[model samples]
Target: MRLIKVDHIINFKLLGHGDDPLDTKKCHIDLNALRAREDAAIRRAEIEAERIGAGVTTEAQSIFDALSKTLPVRWESTVIVVLNEVRVSSPYKPENVVGGAGAANERVKKVLELERKRMQHGRQ
Candidate 1:
């Protein structure tokens, strides 16, 4: 008995003894095309992931906007920055507020807490 091993499965008729020779060209798999398709799919997935990661959530954006009204605020990735000193990470809880010291940081933390609660209540 003859045996053949293949990494990829392709549908083709097996040639029995005394049968006409099989066409090698028709049975070949285009590795380059397969690789290109795989690469394209990976690239598309990466692009989508990057797009999603680049934007902050509506809640985070609203908080940022509110803070911007009375304080120096900017976004560092998904984290919110205030006065270039304090960093508020996602979930935007008061405990997540960090960095800096003094009255200004405390004020920022208070504002964040209030905004977070207000937004939370507004949602319900």
Candidate 2:
């Protein structure tokens, strides 16, 4: 097997040199990007709290709200990291997995739309 190293723009680093596609390897994480994500989550949560007239003054609550967004697609960047790994490790190369790289993005969009309709109808 050939060693493959990937340096993702989103700060994901994967170094795999094995035969098994599913075999995991050490991943180098970017502290700066992680911190930025945390900061963004908190900021968005605060904005949502204000919009919904909810009192979310603590960092913990803010982070929680941000993780559970009304439109989860806003957090889809995190999901992309996993999909990228799958693509990189796969033996067969297809133009795209599941109809294209935007498959997850489209799925997230559909989920958000469904959530909106559910909320509008006062359904869970």
Candidate 3:
């Protein structure tokens, strides 16, 4: 929860709210309310933080240690996954020099693998 500050003022008929006039004692009351409100707000935020810290991370997959849980069992298997392979040939290769296109393919393969991992993590 977020707290927002609000400014309040009294409207005197003679002043007509055009020329500003404020009472300090009235402000003191508002300030006291604001202080106690702030203290209560802080306590609420700390409680929320404690709740978050207490939340259990149940069986999370490390980016390294395989997010693929649930037993990759037999042919029947415990988990199901679909892998994809795509091949695209760009007509324009940069510089068009020797081995440039082959180098590009190697780069594309790495990018594709990275994209796959990213998509999987996003699902998680």
Candidate 4:
């Protein structure tokens, strides 16, 4: 991938060796641009890792993933919101789930219990 700086925007182009004879012969590579891109990517990865490590347990994340399959899920600080109505707080137990319509609340509780059992049994 070749990164081109055009004004303030960065553009990427995929070039194959020997595809463009003239361009290949010229062989004008931007080492600075490549280095900048690499540095930016590394910084982004570090930031993402830090965000994921911020008190979100694997159990809580797994529960959120499962619930998101059939419902709208979002994070409210350390809490997981389901269907925009139900809130599942940390320690993510059935009892920790609160505030939702009747059916949605029941579904969230069932998911929490099922996830808990799955984790306890070490099942994927």
Model 1 Cα lDDT, one tens digit per residue, 37-97: 9999999998555433247788777788788889977677888888889988988877888
What are the per-residue Cα lDDT tens digits for candidate 2 across 42-123?
9999866443312333332332233245323111222211222222111111222233257654543454345445445764
Q: Tell me how far the alpha carbon of residue 17 in candidate 3 is from the true structure, in angstroms, after superposition.
A: 8.9
What would the C-alpha RMSD of candidate 2 be, to one decimal place?
23.6
TM-score of each: 0.53, 0.26, 0.26, 0.57
* Cα displacement (Å) at residue 52, model 3: 1.5
Give the least accurate 10-residue stretch of model 2, judged by summed lDDT: 86-95
Candidate 1: Cα lDDT at 40: 100
Report the C-alpha lDDT of model 4 over 5-51, residue by residue, as the tens digit: 67866675778556666677778889999999999999999855533
Q: Candidate 1: lDDT over CA atoms?
A: 0.79
Clashes of 3: 0
Model 3, span 1-124: residue lDDT tens: 6555545444424645553448665454568888999999999998555323122222111211131232121111211111212232221122211232555445544543554466578889
lDDT of each: 0.79, 0.40, 0.36, 0.81
Q: Residue 79 of model 1: what lDDT?
A: 81
**Position 29, candidate 1: lDDT:** 82
Whose lDDT is greatest here? 4
Angstrom error at residue 33, model 3: 1.0
Task: Compare the candidates by TM-score and give the number of the best one.
Answer: 4
